[model samples]
Target: MTQNIKKLGYFLLFTFVTLILYLTYLVMVQGEQLARHPQNQRIAAQEAGIIRGTIYDRTGTIIAETNWRGKQGERVYLKQDQLTPFSHITGYVSQRYGAFGLEASYSKELLGLTEADYLENLLDRILNRTPRGNDLVLTLDTVLQRTALNALGGRRGAVVAMNPKTGEILALASSPTFDANEIDRPEVWKQLNQDKLNAPLLNRATQGAYPPGSVMKIVTGAAILSQQILKPQDKIQCPGYTVIDGQRIKDNRSHNSVDFNKAIALSCNTYFALEGSKLSWDQFEDNFKKFGLSATPDIGVPVRSGTLAKGERRNLSQLAESSFGQGDTLISPLHMALACSAIANNGIIMKPYIVKEIRKPNGKPISVTEDSLWLTATDPEVAKQIAQGMVAAAKWGTATAASIKGLEVAGKTGTAETQGNSLPHAWFVGYAPAENPKIVVAVIVEKSGSGGIIAAPIAREIFSMALAR
Candidate 1:
């Protein structure tokens, strides 16, 4: 009996020791995973108790913030109640849905829990107090945003303006916008939820993808320039249409013969079709990808990854259609702005950035964001040639509608045809001060025909406002 008792005691001790070791391993190795588990409502509730930091524009304008209230003997930090019209940028913290936009993207830093935040917290603890959370300063300009909105005039479209040198998004405006104030309200939510034609919640500037139309000629020009398949002086004959594999491709413009520059300036489909056919599908796909046509901009916004279609050589007709911004080619306005950034920055494309800096509540600088290169167009000479073509387009080509009176504007216009009875989408992408650019703008008008008439003028107005500012 004494031996059995001693054996039982030893077994209990060993089991207890093993359990403790397993628990310690779980805490050390899988703590973060457990905290992020959906069942951990307590951790989420604690996060909700703390006041999230504010988001400001470059001019110190409060784009998004939380307002604390001591109402009915209860302390509440209301997010949607304080920030309206800017919800798309700030996003909302909902009880039902997880955080989004800047809120979700920068949660660690905003909540004072990042590595930098940990150091600051430790320092503050040693000093016998808590450090404040950091604030995000954006590169947006309120004036430009307002002007862009006004220019849209309730049209179904989007406008994106950025500093070419810095890749700082100055203004982003999407029409048919919603009021963030009504997000938590049942009635307003019902209305917004039901509406189909006017998707007030969609961020068209980054998420909306459309056929690029003739504006795609810019990429074709780049491909031709890079492959050395053709020279700027090389001419192609056009009878308003070209046939490849018994398929007819039409040019909107009726130019008999056009050189590379003239073809781009007039947006001649035949010229690009012939040049695009000379290169293999892989070559075409590679060049398009280089221009960001087949990629997504890492701007923290929900961006669509535009696609370039692939198929057999007999699909050359389909590929030719894509050369002029038709068929299976699609792109977002934000990506188009980046493309223009490449041209404006002399073939060096900078990554698009929104946040400029972060700071503590006491006004101490905590973090600052610097400009970074995203991609370089294959050849600088090609970008230069494209810039010259864009200059001519603004001066005497289809993009003349975008010409600013005093500022040297270089631009390209695109009118993409869609299936069924829908009107074509209008597109305009450009950079200003032709020789030395300061800003790049991309505008898209859904179901609005004639890029020269609709999209170009709006881009010109935005450019003019930016210059004046």
Candidate 2:
């Protein structure tokens, strides 16, 4: 009986110790993910009565802050310039509506819940002190963001601009934006939630996915050059259209046999569709996967992954369609911008980041961001050839509207045709000063025919503004 008791005691002690260790592991490993999770209801309660941190633009413009003196969180959206343009960036936080965007991504940091600040606050708890949240200093440039939004002119699309070298997002503007101030009201919430046509609540910049159209030709071009399947100057004949997998693929215009540069510049669909057929499905998928079409990039807000297909077994016709950004292929504006930025930055895609710094409540710097490489999709030589083609497109081809006199911009235009009655979506992705690139911009105008006419001009204005800075 004593032996039985001793064995039971030993088992119970072992179980208790194992449970404690497991909990400690969870605290150390899963702690940040748990605290920042959108489903954590405790965040809403804490936000109701806590002094959350301020959010600022790169230029020190206060985008969001809470009034702490009265009732803990009189969450105030300051009437700053270009506030509406940044609505998706500073997403709404409410007890009723839940949370998303930066409000959710950095919730733990903003709530001062990270393990680094834990023990300091434990001492505060002993002294009965009210803890303050940490401030986020974002990388967004207000002037650039406003330029992008205004350039969109209330269209149903988005624009994402970034520093190609550093991956610092200069501007992220989604069209049909709503006033964040109206979020607390029931009527406004219901109206925004139910509106089907515009869907003003959708953050089109990072979350909305559309057929990439000719802009996807950039990826196709990368694959061709990287795999050594085609030379930069390889000649191909385009008699308006060509048969691919029994489907007659048509180009925008008839062009006699031309080299790779002219094909890319003119966005000859026949050339790309034919080139795409030469690649096996594995080669095709591998190229785009390297370019991040298969996954969501790590950005400050929520981003949906752009998809190439729904299944593993892809038909030849599907490959042709996917080659030109049609069929089942869809991509987010930010994703395309990053891809273009990769080309601009010598094939090294830097990881995109918005928040540049984190500061304590008293304005002392906690940490500063260090830019890192996200992917090396191709050789610099291959990327340079693609860049040259983009420059040709800007100078003498479909992207002439995007050309800025004396600035030497390199760009690509895309008009992705949609099904049924929906018109083609206009797309323009580019970088400035081909020799020494600075800002890379991606502009998409929904159901807008002709990327050169509508989207390129929009991008031109943004590039003009960014360069002026």
Q: Alpha carbon lDDT of residue 2, candidate 1?
A: 100
Candidate 2: list runs displaced more than 4 Å: 1-31, 78-83, 119-129
Q: lDDT for model 2, on a 0 to 1 scale?
A: 0.86
Residue pairs of candidate 1 with colliding backbone atoms: none
lDDT of 1 by residue, 30-88 (tens): 87656544345654565554455777888998776656443111112223322243556
Q: Which ten residues in a row have the lowest lDDT in candidate 2?
A: 74-83
What TM-score would candidate 1 get against the native?
Answer: 0.86
- Per-model TM against the reference: 0.86, 0.91
Alpha carbon lDDT of residue 316, candidate 1? 78
Best by TM-score: 2
Cα misplacement distance, residue 261 of candidate 2 (Å): 0.5
For model 2, how does the per-residue alpha-carbon lDDT over 140-249 read when each residue is reduced to its tens digit? 98888888888888889999999999989999999888878778799999999899999999999999989999999989988988887888778988899888768887
Best model number under lDDT: 2
What does the lDDT come to for candidate 1?
Answer: 0.79
